[model samples]
Target: MMGNFHIVSNNPMVAEKYPDLTEFEKDSKVKDIFAEGRNSIHLGANLINHPLAGSIKPNQSPYKSLVMSNEKGELDMFSLKLIEGALQVLKKFPPRGIEYDEQTLEDFQVIDLDLLDSAIDSLPYEYHE
Candidate 1:
């Protein structure tokens, strides 16, 4: 099984000029809170009292190792599993280095936008089981 995540951001300037994304942001509450709490732990005591924290931490958990976990716990079995998982990724499929993106920002003015559109639309989509 393979999991892939892609992030495509619309230009904020484009939306500002056109005003289409403003409605979406308004409805989603995306812009309402730029950040949630106090900037630091010393100042964040009040914000730390959320009910979600009660059930989120598990006993003898991985959080104890890397997150809330002590240093000794991290050097134990959990590190073994972490190393194995990383090795699996490397063994199964190593990363490919980019070899073909020679275009510079200056080359953009000469590029054909229609060809770019056609190339994007020509790719076939595959569904994972």
Candidate 2:
């Protein structure tokens, strides 16, 4: 059986904190976690943009949809460890915009919400029809 581990978050903190989980996977601890039967782990700024990535809101759902699997896929202890490791890295960094382009305002959205609205409104009026 083959499976994959993915970490997706709109939070730019991910990019800033742990730029690459693949690099961390090289660590003995990370390797041991995925020893079970996982294929790969990835980190991204937007989960919704990825083909395999989806968003899960705790209150909106019965369970946390943080992880996903193929029809026959599942996450094991190793997967949890991988998430933990990534989270630890995020905690260390603490989303302070330390790194250039790390979690920029654009990631969250422009400073002015109305600017976005104006841009959207400015789009070809014919499209509305």
The lDDT for every candidate, in the order shown, is 0.23, 0.29
Check candidate 2 and list the clashing pairs.
none
Indicate the residue-level lDDT of 38 in model 1: 14
Task: Give me the runs in candidate 1 sitting further than 4 Å from their true place.
Answer: 1-70, 73-75, 99-129
Off by over 4 Å in 2: 1-67, 72-75, 98-129
Candidate 2, which ten residues in sequence have the lowest lDDT sum? 56-65
TM value for model 2: 0.25
1-129 per-residue lDDT for model 2 (tens digits): 112322222323332343442122222322232222133333221121111113321111111112223223233555545555544543454333234353443443232223223433443433233
lDDT: which candidate is best?
Answer: 2
TM-score of each: 0.20, 0.25
| Count of backbone clashes, every candidate in sequence | 3, 0
